[model samples]
Target: MKKRDILFFSAAFVLALLFGCGNGSSQHSFALGDSTFMLDNKPYQIISGEIHYPRVPREAWRARMKMAKAMGLNTIGTYVFWNLHEPEKGKFDFSGNNDIAAFVKIAKEEGLWVILRPSPYVCAEWEFGGYPYWLQNEKGLEVRSREEKYLSEYKKYINEVGKQLAPLQVNHGGNIIMVQVENEYGSYGADKVYLEMNRKMFVDAGFDGLLYTCDPEKDIVKGHLAGLMPAINGQDNPAKVKQAVRNLNEGKGPFFIAEWYPAWFDWWGTPHHKVPASQYTGKLDTVLQAGISINMYMFHGGSTRGFMNGANFRDTIPFEPQISSYDYDAPLDEAGNATDKFMKFRAVIARHLPKGEKLPDVPAAKPSMALNAITFDKEIGIFDYVGPGKVNENPLTFEDMNQAYGYMIYQTKVTGGAKTELKINGLRDYGIVFIDGVRKGILDRRLGQESMMLKVPAGTHSLEIFVENMGRINFGPNLLKNKKGIVGEVTFGGKVLKSWTMFSLPFDKVETSKIKETKSAKQTPVLKLASFEVAKPLDTYLDFRKWGKGVVWVNGHNLGKYWSIGPQQTVYLPAEWLKKGKNEIVILELNKPEINQLSSLEQPILDQMSDNK
Candidate 1:
């Protein structure tokens, strides 16, 4: 056996001595003490790395965990996105990539402990901040608050996730060591009662292990529960962060950094976020020397596939959707390969390991291939693939239409009022305005424009507005009111427009074969299809470098979107999603069919910031 294996077993043997082995008893517990967290009645410091399961392919979970372990991290931290598990109300899915229990089991098999932050309201740049869109449909339901309606639903989700994870706690002979309650609540609101309620709900649902609260340093005290262990996030000043945690923990000695950001996240049309290893290593070293535990926010950030990506906006910044890549400039790149940052971090971790201990070997890089351009042989117009929709008196929100994600079209007629200015109230993101089936103006929320002046001719004319969800706010005070599509009213020259025909284009799934074929040289949105053969399957990126703004699909799976004005020009196509012999691709070109062919690139172009950036 390896020396490291021997050392690990020795520690386990000691734990077994203190607490009985095999289906451990209550005595074999992980508890929170004033000064330290006790495991098997001994102080233990958790060294963890965060990785979201849905963002990663199920086949790669073990490999990623192995990478985390190889980096000397003893624990794995992850948030359970509620929207993914329970896409609709009372409908829960825990199979495949949504399998929380299986993920925890894999972590245990890898000899790593787990820290579950099943926030349910996890603001991880995920659509709707992990809240189900159905929640918005609840007549008076206020999320992240003391609202009974919201709490009841929150309870159901918490119970479901808990049932899958609680039995796997270390006390029950499993690896889960900690459970965080209501992530960064204080940053959104200061509700002590709400935080306590979340804690109670977690306990009622069966999570009896080390329960805690994690928030930024500014919101730590406000979000913290009186008896719960309070952890700080994001701050780099070790002394100040330690002091803050100590103060919150009642002069405690054990300090924890719940989220140590090695790098920041990127928004669409913005430059990729990066930080030199030198920027964080010195601070990391200081924390380790001080004996403080930490969980690297994203040891590896994978792709935010499909429509799961989120958006963000502040006073200065407008509504900006995050690119599909959740790379975060992490030590491990989006494809799960190590970068220079990885080597630098590994060296730092090795130097900090307990005396005579060693980290496992880093895994090898995954294979990638570059193929020649894929010429689309078949094409169809957007109208050829229109699904069934409803007609409302006025334009309704996506949630109002029972739609979760994707685009929606609102068409109305301009009759009496020859309005100069047209306004769409509560326009979530981007909208393309047209009159008489001709494109006139584009109202992009990112540019802080929601209204446009229409040069309408006399008599009744067709008024069409095609709006993209862009993405719902995944963080901040907007989390509660994040209803996509036009929320309230549509006005023309201060006149409330009535009687509308709306179409739901909630591209949940597209059937390429079912779509009718049509060819037209006229400028309009088109769907293009192509096929290619590969002898062996290897990971490759679908190059949309030549294509305009639109979504891509491979073998009936949505690969997410790409835009001409982009920092992301390619969509990652995992080998698991590829076929051994023949592979197929379908692109739903949104604006213009500039090209009839698409190419595959050996690498991704995720840092080419757009013009408006």
Candidate 2:
């Protein structure tokens, strides 16, 4: 009887051990401060690189993850761009490039952890800082605040994103270990309630991983929560790092540099920002020596592609628009080539790792090419092609003209007497007005100047005005606004003119291709045709440094706005977008007439000589 009782007791003990050890709770629940970022208590150090899902194409997700891992990064930090995921109210996109769940699953397959920063407002210098344009349309919607309307929409976004990622958190056998609250909130505002609301939403949505806030050292005090970890962003000073922890936690347990800037981004008409490789390498070494962890702001800053780069405010200026190419002068260039900064940083990291630990080999650089001369002829003025539609008596704004993006041309015949005082009433941003064949006046948005006076020939003369929609303002007081073309009246001798014929040039690829030649006295004098051939498709930058100013296209894909301005000379051309054998290139130079020939260089167009010089 004793032997049988012993056998029964042993079986019961074994069953209990198996069920308890294999329960779901064991796999979920990440514990920081413990080694391995322990689920049920283990040690973990998250080595992550920041990558935005919308910035990188879906086809390249796995490849990019592989690159991150190869760089000795065990985790991938991705920010969920609200505008891309939910461009319209109540509508969401989790497919293709917007498929964040697929991206997380693929990261797991690649043996990488995830740090999710699902900021409904991600100020990655992205258009509207990742906020949807429709949010701006809402009358008086306050961003990054506790405003009811804004919070309501933000909660909806968090829920939708959580549905895709909450189940994949480390607690759920997936690799996501931490979910970030509103990105850099303290720098924008001191809405602790809004930040807490965001945190609660993620927790309620089932994201049980560690919750944290990222901001500069000064912001740590205001931005961080008492219970959660505080991660600093863009802080390289050691004292600042220590202070960030002290300010947030009176000396906290886990401290990380969420974003360490390796380089800066270039804006149109501004000088290219190039931080020395030595400075970046030294900063990284200092942080690592102090045993502080950091994530390179962008291990690889990819192309902005299309109209995605955001704009900022400058005192009195309406907006300071960023160039489309977000090259960022990063460790990895826009085309994904490892720069000198990459090598220096890698060597620095390799030196600091534990003994016998070696950094992975750097990936091979992709190939690039320069195209021969390509030319485009402007056979007619854009206004001459207007069809049967009745001409509006007054000029229309870009939106009123039903043009969402690109350039528009307004032309009128002046029948009144010539006057020295000519004023453009409501010029939105910039305009180049020409009276007959002579340049009359220039209006710029930055100065808030909307008119210019020019000597005019009396009685039936051509008045041509060309206006471009500068990238929309993405932040600050005027965010909900749209500015394009001439907004008001054209006045000559204190009297406003009427009956203007407008030409809308949104530059749709199809529409541009169908443009036909037309003869008009106002038509451009030179008709240029240029062609180039490439043996294989490679990422090539058309040197805009040659032309004064213009827009360019490679095989129907618009490369975005290029100007002969000082700072941005190079436009990025992705290899995936280029085609083999005879890729067509087109350019519409604004100020240049006789200098028609165009050629591509091996380097970036921004690298080309400044047109102003």
Candidate 3:
């Protein structure tokens, strides 16, 4: 049903050959035909699973690849997070966990091909859709646009990524068979010119392998270019998926599902989403029977560590920040253990592997440890750890101060109106208003409340607003405008507030030695210190069910945030970070520190997704 006629840019291919661009020590060739792709001119089917290199630790990359191979997968797909690769403009770090080339090379060693989705803009519920925080300050630089300012920066980043990956392409005698162009662009806009530019950029950067555009079935036509191959996403209906792909590619036979959602991601205050196996099983079978290629969106979703989690703002939802755990309820759990779904999926995948090629043996489970309740006796006042702040005439946004993540404090003097109407125009997220170090009121964006009537205690009262960078918006129309902290002017009683001393507490400078011991905190947001001893280092989840909302640090490494209002009661702590005998834990409790005991659980309480909504 599919045409085998080769369709390619002859000039580019010839140039690639002449320049020895496609030449490599390992000999292999990959090219796109009408219906299906070809390996050495033979029809090939890509049975792949998506996994992020940065999400999983560098030590775990090989094991994860083996897990995928054992599940009867021939290919492993990954997105090259632009922000992770290049946190700042012109500053690139490919070492440690950011070593994508190493990840790919490991996949090759595990006998698996790779699909590189290097989107300068990756909307994987990542901070600012993977755009660097510095981009916000660039005037007139609209992100995800074809505008010069944005594109110029993007070109440099993509070129850098290419430098790391182009030579590893399948045509270059490497395992990287295909490289995606501008991830799911059609879902965002109907700009053909933009898609075209992205395709050209890939070719220019030395990716001579198959280049394709993946879009939602509905938007495939809008997102696709004339020459590039089109793939559908989030569509389980085999008939519809095939129809969509064929319609776009003039009756092309072999269909590919770019992102097959096994389960969905979770937000802070909402129930975790799950797709029952029964619901997706039949569709998966139908597609496999029809000979369609699919890449499970997330085969294994590791933690969204640090402040990289993104938020979701829908029609009714205000702004829901994603929880640290990216555990998408996939075949592999957050801890990389195989779920029941994994076994079942393996059974299904086994039915369609190439002749005589068998799946590898599943790896043994990693041991987890349970520890006794450790008490936190020492206490530190949060106010004592304040960094040297700068004085400004007006409060600056987090981007203005070049502070990317964590919290910021805006302190100034307020007077005049007795019941002053305090308004924080464009408040980024949760902000607690304090008058002269006393808690006055709370201004939260979730409740859709911004302006609060403040009772200005006579004369000049010290006004302090502590704002936390909850998370940046990851997808949709509001993506380009996701700047943390306050964006616009703060007005009180029709008068613009000025002459403010702001603290840029990015928390990157958080050190245990720097904090002073205190007897007690008068109010909420107090820092507590505790130490626990482990027989030996083993993987454990730090349970914070007793504590209120805030963050936890284990041996100076942030375990991420936890709240009483949780589907997530504990943060995952890798064994590598835990020392043998004594381990120190620090918690910055935002609300009441009701419990002082800290314990580690062998199992994680991730799916409590009740009506915390």
If both were scored by TM-score, which would come out higher, candidate 1 or candidate 2? Answer: 1
> What lDDT tens digits, residue by residue, belong to model 1 across residues 80-107?
9999999999999999889989898888
- The Cα error of candidate 3 at residue 241, in Å, is 1.7
RMSD of each: 5.0, 6.6, 6.8
Q: Tell me the lDDT of model 3 at 282.
A: 71
TM-score of 3: 0.92
TM-score of 1: 0.93
Best-to-worst order by TM-score is 1, 3, 2
Better of 1 and 2 by lDDT: 1
Tell me how far the alpha carbon of residue 175 in candidate 2 is from the true structure, in angstroms, after superposition.
3.1
lDDT of 3 by residue, 392-454 (tens): 898888998888898888899888448889998888898888887777777878778789988
TM for every model, in the order presented, reads: 0.93, 0.82, 0.92
| Per-structure clash totals for the candidates | 0, 16, 0
**Model 1 alpha-carbon miss at residue 117, Å:** 0.5
lDDT of 2 at 282: 76
Alpha carbon deviation, residue 238, candidate 2 (Å): 3.3
Score each candidate by Cα lDDT.
Answer: 0.83, 0.70, 0.81
